[model samples]
Target: MSNPSSKPIGLEIDLLETQGGKVPLEYFHKLISQLQKNHSLDHLSASPASAGEFDVVYIILSKGTLYEETETNAYECIIIDGWSCWPAGFAYLLVPPNRRREKANISGGDNGPSDTADIKIALLPIAQTRGFGRFVIRTLLSHAFDALGIRRVTASILCPIQPSHSVAQKKQVGFNTKQLCWIFEKFGFKFEGISRGALMSMSVVEGEEPVWHDVHRMSMLITDYFQEKRSLSLSAMRSFSREFPLKVVQQSPWEIMIQRQEKEKHDVESWSKRPNDASANDACGNDGEASDDETVLGGDEISEK
Candidate 1:
């Protein structure tokens, strides 16, 4: 059933910031506290759409932050809007240093690990299906490929077998596993396989037996990112922008890459037409790798402007 109190609307994503593992203990508490008191999120704690249905939905639903540190190389990120500073959600990335070393030991370091990373996300109920999820994933993928230079990004989505229910009265609260799989596929992530018992139960009830759930593992390589970027049409881009309605205080790595590529292309064209102009040559001296920004914007026509 559609939420009576909620309406589907564009979300204005203002910021995506990451903090090191050394984040103060109190910061987590503050975030959790703010989320718990926000009445707009009460549904997520009690409704089927609650993140608790898939993962351990704490911090906002329960008493504690559900924060844990298993990997030393992981980083936590917060998403917010610049206008009202609304906390939309949280995400984390795990980048292991040993991956490169292990690959080097096996293959003489020529191809190495290619810098693989893993990401997980948790969004508030108020932010669900508002295109904030897409924005977050896009920004993260851009950061992984361009800023961190990661070659592959992986995500494990919970896809447990849900209990059978009456189909007639069934109300869709949020994206089911199948829909989520389709969404990720559209983003160029390939389905790897099912990971049986991939996650442990995070039930808050006392004396409850622990249960495990299966997850579908999916991955996207840097090559996949490039291919998707090239294939993305102007209409699709406009749709995404309209869905998210972003007013970013900090540009995502993807946006930065686009601007850089545009500047470099302009410089090269200027130098080509003015061979005698030393300034043009100097400006275009750097052999920067080209991006698919222009091609994506122009789509089939391929614009020069």
Candidate 2:
């Protein structure tokens, strides 16, 4: 089987340039129109293809440091095509080294400060359902960790106030419940303090809220019960046997050598008690001659009678 990393997945990333020329508004408008028709950007209060809706754009267009690794730094924009179709794809922006400290403290410690080039991912609404969201995420992570020398990257998924949070938890994305109380908190994105039951509110269409509490409780209960069962099974197995499993099954090397030495000693003693081979052979020859002589004499006596 081929390694998954070696496969030619063919994703192209480009840096957006802010100087010398402007992207025609019509291009963005068309892109946004397509996004609105197919996706749920309204929940996040974001318009398709607009810089205003994306955090990555602010870092790229204003900062002028983001660039595609595969392409020359000279090229300002990249056009991605010729792959599986998805509603939403990600745009990556590289954060310069000088600015990373100012941006966010991702993990604690100054242990080997990360290079200034950081990546920020912006999700397009059109790329959401066709598994593009996950694909982009994986691809970006691969690039960041493998190619770009980046230690960290951040992205947000907008979650509905209730049951949708469960999906986020299932996906293992960070969630901040306190951020959920704030009206302006970015959907699926939190500054910090995210945990399994923390809710982050994003706009939701009116309907029956999802029953996440049941799922959460069930997840915990199942985990606890399985752990208890595993512990009991292990204890029972251990108590059922008096000897260590290894000791009961096989002799140690030292014990095997000692047994062999004792067997050799017994054989030597038994051989010493037995008569010598030469003496036994001589006694057999003498006995055979005596028997022959007795047979001949008996035959002569019978004939004389």
Q: Residues 1-305, candidate 2, lDDT per residue (tens digit)?
A: 22222322433333224412233344334434544554433223223343321123321111122333564542233233333222133344444443344345555555444443333333443222333333443454455445544544443334334444476564443233222223112111224322343333433456855332110110112233335446656766676564446454788999999999999999999988967467755655664355555676784465642
Poorest stretch of ten by lDDT in candidate 1: 53-62
Error of 1 at 285 (Å): 75
| Candidate of highest lDDT | 1
lDDT of 1 at 118: 70
Q: lDDT tens string, model 1, 1-305? A: 33212323444433211222322335454554544554322212123222221121112111112333564422234332222233455554555454434434644434535467776665655556665566666766877787667789887676433234345322341245556667778778999987786665443357865555567778999999988876665556676788789786998999999999999999989888944546754664445634355445764476467
Model 1 residue 6 CA deviation (Å) reads 24
User: Given candidate 1, what's the lDDT at residue 227?
Assistant: 85
Please estimate how well model 1 matches the true structure, expressed as its whole-model Cα lDDT.
0.54
- What lDDT does the true structure give each of the candidates? 0.54, 0.38
TM-scores, all models, native as reference: 0.46, 0.31
How high is the lDDT of residue 237 in model 1?
A: 66
Instruction: Please name the candidate that would achieve the greatest TM-score relative to the true structure.
Output: 1
> What is residue 46's positional error in candidate 2, in angstroms?
7.3
